[model samples]
Target: MISAKRIRIEKNQEVSANYVKKKMDFINYLDNDSLAQIFMLLPISERITMKEVCSKWQEACQLAWHDIKKYKCTNTIVRNHKKCILTQRYVEKVLFNCGIYLKELILSLICDSSIMPIIAEHCKNLKTLEFALVEFGNKNTYRFVEAFTQLEQLKVVKIHISGYNFQFRMLNSLPKDINEIHLFFKPNGSPEISFDSGIIKSTLFTTMLFNSDPVAPSFFSLKKFTNLRSLTIHRCIITDIIQEISRKTTLVYLDLEKCKTKKEIFTFNQLLNLEHLNIKDVSFMDIPNLLSGIFNACKNLKHLDAPDFHVDLAEIKMENWVNWRNLVHLNIRWQASDAIIENIIKHCNNLEFINIDELNSESTIELTKLENLNHLDFEVTNIDNEVMVAIINNCKKLKHLVLPEYNMVKASIFYDLSKLQYIESLNLAFSFKLGDSAIIAIAKNCKLLKCLNIKNCNITSSGYIALTGLKNLEELNIEMSVNVEDNFVVKLRGIKSLYCSGCHELTDTGIIQFIKNNPDLEFLNISFNTNVTMDTIIAAEEAVKNRTNDTFLAIKSVDSDIEKACHEASKNRTNDTFLSIKTNDPDLEKACSESQWLIDC
Candidate 1:
């Protein structure tokens, strides 16, 4: 009784349905290992639903997460459309599946009350825990300890208290047998809870401020704990503690911050085994004497963070020069004369890491002399071309280097880094004169680079294209790069994070090419581009959706979606501009900005 046209349309519909069924059923052919790998990459939202699709997939999801040893629940979302790990549903899923196998747990929560109870009931094998939580006085402190008391294997706990007023009562209820504890809080009220200062555990604690008093003798004690190897105390009286620990030869690491002493001077000679001493923001009246004592005594000091070293040439006693040979890390945060710096370099010849942020004179420290340097940080510093050339030529063994924020070096001098074959991370974010040749040289020689940050250097598409050869690069920051365009992006591959904000030459089709080409791309910032438009956002979202949809054709579907995006763009994109229709659409602008916030925030 049906017409001939209706019969033809029905036949075509039947064939189309059969094709879709075949495509949907393709997942059943994948082996367990392959399915598990696919499940591992699926975002939290779809992965949960995908597991319920079939019994085989359920097993694959289980296998995918069974080996996880660390569980992190945070508000940081690294990818678009994926819910943050702090979401209760996601946290519950992780805890329910792999909580028993977890050895470490990290929680960065907004409100303290919501998830603490849920987390405490799981992760029995957790050996360490770190969290940031709000304070609620005594009742919350009791709840906090009760929640964690079940973790029998937990040995280390680091806590960051968040609240407007913290009485620091949480310390009393913390696990007593915990061998190592580090607590960070802004002490707001009176100091109430106390610890067994005599023979207590090794602890790194920031204590309550004692009403502007320079010393708080009765607040805390450090009479014993001979087994303690590391100690960090902040804003408390440290004179007596030092007197007590001076004889504790087992102590090797000490960090004192803003701690004052009732006495005018002290000595560290007794702590001969000290290897790492970090003193910051403390009274400097006795630091010179303390440092001189330390230099004279501690023969194995590998790490020293003392900015209070305002010592001059005369105080640079050659008798202590032998101790400098063992120094591996030196951070000059404040004053240092050219002669003192030269002596530091001359004596600490085996130094592996040096950060001098306060350098003013280009002649202060000769870069060429530091042949053994592995990491150099000159951030916020000023240096001339001669120093730049010396670094390029001499410090070739550097694994990490941060050039001055701004430099006047010529492109020719910047382009000849053929000797730095071992460089791993380089930040040329504001070196304005650097151009394509420099990037080409870096790509040719620095093949081991993993992080390259060139936020606003004078780089063009050719320079960016040269970067495509850096297969090991994981993060690239090209914010405000004016010359970047689609030809460079479409050819690039395998980067996790890319910041290309203010790149005006990129368009929707080019960005679509990038999104579909790079499967591992987690973050992309094409904000403020002059040519990108609404199609780019829709394409990015579509590509990500295809990836998380649990279909075998997800990647193949991306290309088809891009074709659709082109068609859609031609039909609707009349007002967008620069990485946008034209940068005038309010809705498109909001979308571009929000895309950047997932990672930047």
Candidate 2:
């Protein structure tokens, strides 16, 4: 009995509604592969939240989980596992819910013995395992090793034993196919275990022993690893391992940092394939001969960290480094002359990084010829303006320049630095000569600067305003810089970490306003600002709570009389507060200890 015209209008309206709903379903239009790709771009927390949106989103999250391969538990979170059951439960939940298989697992905590069996059962495809600060009972050690042996695909294993009454013989239960083994023994503890030459003779590729007793019996001989490529021994005597190392012809990387060894221990002619050699803190009275022998044989060496001893350049020639064309990184604490720099520039054309103690005018001139140099650490007694200009103008690709403890007297140095367009990080700590003009030049020119450290400089409030031009700056450290007042805090923008400790000119109004503007700032250090009271602390807490994000604010002052007053002010706070207040007052620290908001005071 309805009218035909009315029925026709209703049909049209229904069709329009369906069309609009179809247009709104944008995510449903994407294919499964595209949705999975989008899900992979999200952070872990967002990804977890996405699974509740729809069935399609859940499927995409599953696909994303399949791509994950590594899991790590930090040391601090694991330290609380002994007393906090919630921490242990959270770790277990993350492990079980993420994925079924992981390739690498690194735990820097004391793991429970029962958890290893569960990990072995679920993560059967694991290949690399590392544990630091491990504690195990006498019976649990064997069970832990036995559970690890079930993983047929394991390739690398590293363990640092800190518990007492645990024997090293438990290592014999490890699978024979492991290619790398790193073991560290604590002080005053010795393990009663002997290595059978046949156990590790076939497939070992790398070995490291750290902090072992010097007088302990040799566990094994490295000569058995016919395919060894890297070996590292630290804080132990090398007298017993020298012969075994001499026979490793396939060694490519060797590190003997802080090892007790003499000059005659290194006759490294047999290691023809050696490319990276680190001998830091090793006393070598005959350094010239040792270096000559290494340069003659290891022509393919690419990275070398030589001894801290002095080398007489008069005894060596330019031709000695002629075959070192492949060297790219070098760290030497020795004094060198202009001739040494000239030879290095002429031969090592591919040099990209260098750390040295001294450089003269002529030597700096030679350093300008390195077109591929990206990092330079130069410490000198005096540097003139001309040398600084020449180096900055020539090294166009320089990214990191560190001049700690250098005597820089000229303000023209800032003008020279502004020419470096690609520089990202600059450290001029203890250079008391730099003032407002230098900071302004840096802010105007260095567009890509991300980290700036001008600690203990003569920069004032007027100079600090120039930093507002840096849009990409993420870290700024102006500790001990004088004359910083309220106006200086208003100009900061887009900074994730700000360090302004010892700036006594700062007050409560400036800091509270700064915190409100930068609500997402993660770290703020305003220690020694005596004007900052409990009102500033309350303002910071409010700002962070409104955003629902975690932020750390440090406000330690020399005045201790307000400890009781601050403690009384913070007692009413709840556990839901998102701000962590760090202070030096003992009474306030004890009061904040019960609240979850206090991280470390």
Candidate 3:
């Protein structure tokens, strides 16, 4: 039976091919599965063209496109197609479906002097319409705006007009009901005109706007969008954008990645609903009044990203900001200071993830005390036994850890971590002191360890022997582990995701022998390994494709059905999928493996 995806692929072939070709430069852009999933979303013509790219992509593309199209037809008001080409028949269909319940509608064409009238003649019920170009100079964009007046339910509209610049004065009014609007520029681009002069006028009600122009279309202001929920200003260098945003108290999310701001004293009161804020590549000498304003106004805030800045707060000043109890994620690059951590942990009780790249011994100890902490990402130049003991003793709920270079760590300190049973993800990158004992202690203690990253750890065959006991381990990253050989592969038979990149000591004899036997693996990254070649990936793929049902091969001494079911289920699923299987009655070892190390094993 021809699936819906196959039909859609046949309908949208040309555009899909171009998109795939453009993305081919990225080595990790999209795997076969991800591509298959994406292709299903494309129109039939696009999907068909994508299927022709390679025999391997055909079936997955066909199936995915079919399912998504079929699902959309049942609930959507928009018809699926690759690109918009306004024909008489297409125009008639749009006019007839003017009141149609559409979720998404795409329009693509080289808008020159002729295409705008055709689009205006149809497509009034558009929930989403993507335009390739808004033909300028022809004075046709104004007609397009007039047609949008009837699209009362229009939620999203994206227009790209490169060579033709909009007098925008012509676009006197925008669709007030539209929630999302994206404007793109090609050769000529949108005029760098801001609403500063009040030359352009519009009553278009849009929650978000993506303008390629240096200045925002004066249409966006505090009084313009009372119901605005979120705002994103990309590629624009408008000063005091935050000050303008402060007037919009309803804003919940704001992303200012490349924008710069003066040392303007800004308060967070206006953006009271803000929960997620991202400010990247912007420098500030002092985090002045930032924390206090955020805590006072955005009490419900959850995530904060403030990089390349250190903050020194007085204890009294810290008291006012302690009410930020709702914070769950924090990213700050500060000097290693114990007092700072004590203040931070004391306030944010429910913090789940924290990225403090520079950590000191005193701060690491304080980190161990945050009971609600789940993920800890930091880099340390020097870690002592006392700090290690503090981690195992306090950060009992920690599930992931990213360690710094090994030469900076004392080997004896790891022994203390043998008690942190909850740690499931462990990364020991760039380490020199980590040896067999440390690896063995981890293997023996972290029985529930799922991901172990020991890149460049200088581990040997003995380290492999120690790791073999981690039967439940799913991901093993020993990249650049200079001493790792083929024998290490033999020890990682149960790991579903393995990275042996730069393991110069590995040989084909060892790799091929294991690839033919270990079929449970889902991702194998052996890049930069002199011993491995293209044949290695091919061999791994073949093993995965031809995997046999071997339940008896699974270690069954596992205490609960969850572990048994997961072990058996892994044979048919991806590593990530298999890792998600839950165990309701996990063994004591698995339950205790949260952050504290060895509990049962």
Candidate 4:
């Protein structure tokens, strides 16, 4: 009944509609793995929006959500009350969607404690939880603490309470499955909670308490944790608590920084399994006895940092440490005599790292006998030429060496060290007499050098030229080296971070040349170079804009007047410019905020 032409027109229209549908539904053809990868790249905010795009995108987002391992909820609004309810709801939605696989959650904002149940119901796999509460009171904190009882998988919990006076009763209600706990309480705000040893009996791995109060309540007994491995206590004087803890726990690591305790309170004999011990800021007159006890009992001790112990080395026999073959790292802040150094070398043959307060020529020579010494830090009034040569010849495997700030050995020291091909990091900062010759010798010999610090030295432009031969140089700090000029910038080839602050001889033209040559530079510090002007800033902005790759450049300067000029110049620039200029000038900071370019003044 229909004509042939009309029938053909209807069939053509149907074919065109079919083609349109295929084009619109093309994303459905992608496999779930490919779609999941694409969704994983989206930000949490954007991922939430993609869920509504289509069924395929929703499935992809769900798959991506399973891959998320950590999430944080921080205050995003300027005013606290102005944070609309929608923000909380949106966060809840994210938690409900991604909580299935999240292992860590950090909460810093003010959220209702009722939300804890929702998190527990969703994030069953959560292992680490960190809460930083400042203004929030303990009104609903009980609910937050109670919800964790249901999370059997939670292993670590850190709570930082400040500004508000939180009751300690809630601490007694924590889950028993948590293996590690860190509690930080500001002065005067921490409440006095009674001891409930049963609550923390199962927590037997690690515990850290940093209480600012001078006279904090010893609420809990440490004797309950028989399986405790690591313990750290700060500020609070818990002599009795530590004594009980030492008697009960076979701790492997102990940190008593800034903790005040009687000498008789701690006994190291029971802590035979102790490996790492930090007693920094804890003063003890009878340190020799304490060291003897630790070295004799804790033979497995590997890392010992007792920089603040006021002990007379002459009173203790160095032979006590001779049997500590397992000792690898030792840091002592007290002065040691030549005899003490000789004894340490004779006994501690396996030591790879040593940091001492002072060492003389003889002590330095004795250090060469340790073939395993790779990292050495010592202070000396004068660095003898023979001592430097002795170290270079004996410690050929030296990778890190830090000399005294007061010592200024002659240029020949570098010539001797040039033979040490394994040196990777060399710091000669504050050595006023070190000049270009030393750097030249270093560059020629140490081809593997990666980090060099010559701050406050007497290096000139010629010295920087010597650095040009260092192909592996990554970080260079020449702060206060005023003689270094613009010509040195061109020779910097592979450096990622350059600090030339106080180099007054460097000009704006020189800075632009350096920026152009090193397009991949990430950090550049030319602060205090009075010759730097607006042109240098403009060149940095252009370099970032023209780059094909996504690289960030951070330039630091102290010239307030030039920074203002650069801010004004950037007004017409596009937002795609990724240059960041950090200055301490107030006017420049205000101007930067108004401009489209990223500024951190």
Rate residue 26 of model 3 by lDDT: 60
Question: Against the true structure, whose TM-score is highest?
Answer: 2
lDDT of 3 by residue, 1-601 (tens): 9999998897688678877787885633567778777775665445645666676676555445324211111101222321222343433333333314334655545234354444455444446666655345435655665656655556665655444234443333445444554544343332321232322212122222223233443534444445555555433333434567767676777665444444446666677778877666553323464644565557678887766444444433555666568888877555655566677778878888876556666676777677888787656446666766677677888788776665466777765566778889888777777778878788888888889888877677887778878878888888777778877676566766777767788876777666665666545555556666534433433343344421111111223432333343435443211112112335523532332211222
Candidate 4 structure quality by residue, lDDT tens digits, 92-132: 88898899788998876455556788888898888888775
lDDT of 2 by residue, 1-601 (tens): 9999999999999999999999898778898778878988865445666777898887777776666688776322212112111244545655665636689887655466666776777777888877754455556766677766787676677766554334444555555555555655343333222123211111111233322334322444554445557666543345546656766777887776655443435577788788988878754434355565666777889988874744554555455677669988877655566667777788889998866556676676667789988787654545667667776879998888877564665777765788888888888888878778878888899999988888888887667888888988888888886777789787787777788888878888998888887755777887776776667766776676565333444444334433433565567754354556566666557655654455455
Residue 280, model 2, lDDT = 83
RMSD of 2: 7.4
Weakest 10 consecutive residues of candidate 4 by summed lDDT = 197-206
Taken over the whole model, the C-alpha lDDT of each candidate is 0.64, 0.66, 0.56, 0.69
**Which one wins on lDDT?**
4
Q: What are the runs in model 2 whose C-alpha is more than 4 Å off?
A: 1-64, 72-86, 97-99, 108-114, 134-140, 155-247, 259-267, 282-292, 312-320, 335-339, 404-408, 460-462, 494-496, 512-523, 534-601
Tens digits of per-residue lDDT, candidate 1, 341-382, equal 677777888888866666654643464577788887767677
Q: Worst 10-residue stretch by lDDT in candidate 2? A: 197-206
lDDT of model number 2: 0.66
- Provide the TM-score for each candidate, comma-separated: 0.66, 0.73, 0.55, 0.71
- Ranking of models by lDDT: 4, 2, 1, 3
Question: In angstroms, how far off is 157's CA in candidate 2?
Answer: 4.9
| Sequence-dependent TM-score of model 1 | 0.66
